[model samples]
Structures are given as structure tokens and as C-alpha cells.
Target: MTVEQNSAPDTAQIQLTPDESIVLFELLSRWCEDGKSPTPEASCFESTAEGAVLHGLLADLAKQLIAPSKADYDSLLNGARDRLKGNWDFPTLRG
Candidate 1:
């Protein structure tokens, strides 16, 4: 299971499984909860230019999680868990 970002619009790809999708969704939901309005530039999901990039990355992650391969699922789950663990101190973005 490998995720790659390409210059081409349709080239970015991710591969995972149903269980992985559930995990990814849960993590994203937590982020959405932790991250509300007035998001920082680095993490904002509403910026016109950068928002598209963020959305694309998220879409790829969802696709990978929905893939049928167990390896893909494990890879995405591990990556997401590691990311969440490393960034556990994300500041509250809302009042």
C-alpha cells in the first residue's frame, strides 16, 4: 500500500480497506471537531487555493481507506495514528 502525490490532477492515489476507511473517518471527524472556524493557514480547510489541496489529500485518503486490500488499510491506519499521535497537541481553533 502506497500513497503518492503527483503533478497531474488525477495522479494522486491512496489504497486502503473498509475498516481503514472507518478509522480514517473517525480521525478526520476528530480533527473537524478539534478544528473549527478560523483555522490556521497551515491547517485551514476553507481557503480557496489551499483548500483544494487539502480536500484532494483527504479524498485520496478516503479512497485508500475504502480500497479492498488489507495492506492498504494497515498502511493508512498506521500513518493516520502516527500523525494524530505526533500532533496531539493541536490548539483549539475556535472561541
Candidate 2:
């Protein structure tokens, strides 16, 4: 569990593994490419404070991630997804 810390004491820091960063970068890139609200409600991400935070997060992720620029980005994204999903398997039970 390695984390890269920021020297500034005033700001908060969130740490993500390489796989997590790659997966997040791909998701954000898709939202930007589509130019649509991530949710059905336009207000959810149009011009509100939540949207602002998302915008900032996307920018920061872009700076930290390089997988999006690679030719095999899709493969990388799939691999990341698998890693993040881990061993959690959905199960069905009869009532």
C-alpha cells in the first residue's frame, strides 16, 4: 500500500492504485467524449458544485494517467476493471 503524498498541508489527498487510476481515466474520458451528463438528471453534472469537483478530478486524473494515450487503451482498461472487481462474484438465490 504505497501512497504518494502532497507536501502541502492545506489540501487533502486521495491515493489510487495504478489499475484504479487507469479505470477512472477511461470512465472520465468517455464522459467527456460524449458531452452528456453522467446521469439522466442534467442538474447532476451541468453547473453545480458536484460538477465542479468532477471536472477538477477529471483534469487531475488526466495528468496522472498515461494509459488513455496508448494504442491498447481498451485492453488496459479491461485489465484494470478485472483487477478492481477482484473476487466479488454476484450470486443468485431462489426465494
Candidate 3:
């Protein structure tokens, strides 16, 4: 089979939470160890202690970083686009 045949398109749309990011990283580590791809069934990090921590972190990060209003989300997205186009430097605190 060709490289294209072996690789699959990413169809899973996940609204990532910080905790989920950690669990996802852990599972990816395990998959790498086993020399296997992470399947949908294996992708779930719902039960383990680490998974719980990950979920909590994600929830907190979402609450802190994401805008509660649609307008805020749109503004943030527009700002991001402008930054990507080199129109503005991202706000960074140097201290």
C-alpha cells in the first residue's frame, strides 16, 4: 500500500480542554511505545486518574481562555488571523 493508503484523514472534531490535552499526550505516548495508531476506542481518556486530571485542567483552561460570547470568539479569531498574516505581534508580557 502507498503512504496515502496507510494514513487516514482526521475526521474527529474535538473541543480540546487542557486536561484532555494531557491525557491525549499520554495515550499517544503509549501508542508510540506499542508501535500502533490510536484508534477511536483507545482515544477515550475518561476513566483513568490521569484522564480525570486532564479533564479538569481542560475545563479550567476553557473557562479561563475561551470567550463566553460569540462576539468575543469572533474578535479573537480575527485577531489571530491578523497575527498569522504578520499584521501584528502577539501580545506577550516580558518581565
Candidate 4:
């Protein structure tokens, strides 16, 4: 098996029914929209910033769902993760 395949979490395999599938997709879409622009100019649903971001998220999650490899996943997210970690992870703002 490929390294990417191995890194994926077992939870990713949970079979969602059609309804549940749509719910997850919608949640991801709304999340991207909230993070992106709520009034984005893209006319096509698939062409919206939310769509692109959500696509990337899904692709990355597919590659490394759990126990992600540093080189493949953590490395890519390191900067953002590091930047946000201090503010969100710690109780105090003191460095």
C-alpha cells in the first residue's frame, strides 16, 4: 500500500448514507464560505472559493486523515498550525 493510503485515519472509512453524505458536504461548503467570502462572486457552485478550499481540504484529508506524515501533511500545515497554536492552544497569551 502507498504511504498516503497508510496515513489515512480509520474513521474516514465510516459509511455515510446519502442524507448524511449531503450533510457533511453542506457543512464543509458552509464552513468554507464562512472562512472565505459569504458573498463570493463565483456563479458556479463548483467554482466558488469555498468549493476550491473544500476540495483541497477533502483531498488533504483523504491523503492523511489520522497519524498524518509530517512530510505529507503536518509539514504543509506547520506554519498556519504554529501561528494559530499559541493563541488557541494556550490559556494565557503570555509567551
Candidate 5:
């Protein structure tokens, strides 16, 4: 049996405001921390490929976000959230 492999690039580029990026980075970081693996063999997530992608994204965000590493991160993040809320309308979830 022969298998065909696609050679398309596996990377993507996205643009986000600094506020948005910081907020998302905080969310992702918390998610990763909550999903820590017990066994050494198992990675931080259930799926290795997806986990790797998330980790890479987190790393990228870390490089781009200075607020997360600052002493006033909570205040910075809250300000970001407030700015985002003002910029866009988010529909409330319905039961």
C-alpha cells in the first residue's frame, strides 16, 4: 500500500492587538497549567500534536507579551479585558 503525503506548510500567521494577545496568553497559560500530566511519558495535554501547537502558541505569546511577566499583570490583564469589552459586543450566553 502506498500513502500520499501533503507538503503544505503547517504554520499560520495571525495579527492581534496587544491587549487581545495578553488576555489569550493568560487563558492558554492557565489551561496548560490546569492540565498538567502526572506521568513523565504523557505530555501536558491529552493530544500530543494539539498540545505541541498550543505550547508553541504560548511560547510565541510569551515572547510578544511583556505584561504577563510584569508585577502588575493582574491589573494589565483586567485593563486589556476592559478594552476588548469596549471594542466589541459580546452576546450573553443563553440557557
Candidate 6:
């Protein structure tokens, strides 16, 4: 029997502000607890309070992006990209 290890990196590198770190971790933690991954759309969504809040957040972000009229439209767009950026992964983050 034998064992081997790979030393390659699997994620990417990017940056996020302190607030983004908090929000991104919270969001990922919730999905992970349910054994789910965040997708552009959640197919297994329920209409419960928490589920509704999650869906609502997605919808609001979408609406602002489409209309571009909201005060924080640009910031919102950047925040999403920053949060889900590849660097959010552990190895890249810790590095």
C-alpha cells in the first residue's frame, strides 16, 4: 500500500473587505449546514421564513442589477463579485 499527496492549489486569488468576509461566511455557512451549494438559483427552495429571506435577497440583488437605479447598485454588484470570488476558498484565503 502507498499514499501520495498533491501540492497544487485548487482555488483562485482575490480580495474582500471586512464586511464582505462576514457576510460571505455567514451565507456559505447557512448553505453548507443544509448540505447545499449556493447557485444562481436555488431549486430546492421552500417558502419558509428563512427560505423566503434568502430568495428575497437574491431577487433584490437581481432587480438592482437589471435596473441600475438603486443608490448602491454598483456597490452591490461589486460586493457579490467579491464575496463569491475564487479567493474565498480556504487555501487562497489563508495564503
Give the total clashing residue pairs for model 1.
1
lDDT of 5 at 20: 88
Shift in Å, residue 87, candidate 6: 3.8
Q: Which regions of candidate 1 are displaced past 4 Å? A: 1-10, 34-95
TM-score of each: 0.31, 0.66, 0.28, 0.27, 0.64, 0.27
Tell me the tens digit of each residue's lDDT in model 2 across 1-95: 23445553576799989898988776766666567646436754555777677778989998878888999988988998998875455563221
lDDT digits (tens) for residues 1-95 of candidate 6: 23334655466544655445445544644564445665435555554666666655545444433323557745764776676676455664246
Top candidate on lDDT is: 5
Per-residue CA lDDT of model 5 for 1-95, tens digit only, reads 33344655467689999888998898778766656633234553577787778878988898887888899999999998998887656675231
Q: What C-alpha lDDT, on a 0 to 100 scale, does residue 63 get in candidate 4? A: 56
Candidate 4 residue-wise lDDT, 13-90, digit = tens: 456443334434444545554576353346646545766766776564445443233354434344445554454565
Q: Which of the two candidates, 3 or 6, achieves a greater TM-score against the reference?
A: 3
Using TM-score as the measure, the top candidate is 2
Better of 1 and 6 by lDDT: 1
lDDT of 1 at 74: 55
Clashes of each: 1, 0, 4, 0, 0, 0
Against the hidden true structure, what lDDT does model 3 obtain? 0.50
Give all candidate RMSDs, comma-separated.
10.5, 8.2, 17.7, 15.8, 6.6, 14.3
**lDDT of each prediction vs. the true structure?**
0.55, 0.75, 0.50, 0.51, 0.78, 0.52
The sequence of per-residue lDDT tens digits that candidate 3 reaches over residues 2-93 is 99977967564458543344444444445443456653354455557765565565455445553424466545545554444453355742
Question: Which of candidates 1 and 3 is the stronger one according to lDDT?
Answer: 1
| Model 1 Cα lDDT, one tens digit per residue, 10-61 | 6545665544555656555444445654444564445576756545656666
**For model 1, what is the alpha-carbon lDDT of residue 39?**
41
Stretches of model 2 off by over 4 angstroms after superposition: 1-10, 36-40, 43-47, 87-95
Query: Candidate order by TM-score, highest to lowest?
Result: 2, 5, 1, 3, 6, 4
The TM-score of predicted model 1 comes to 0.31
Give the winner by lDDT: 3 or 6. Answer: 6
Off by over 4 Å in 6: 1-47, 67-86, 91-95
Q: Candidate 4 has which clashing residue pairs, if any? A: none
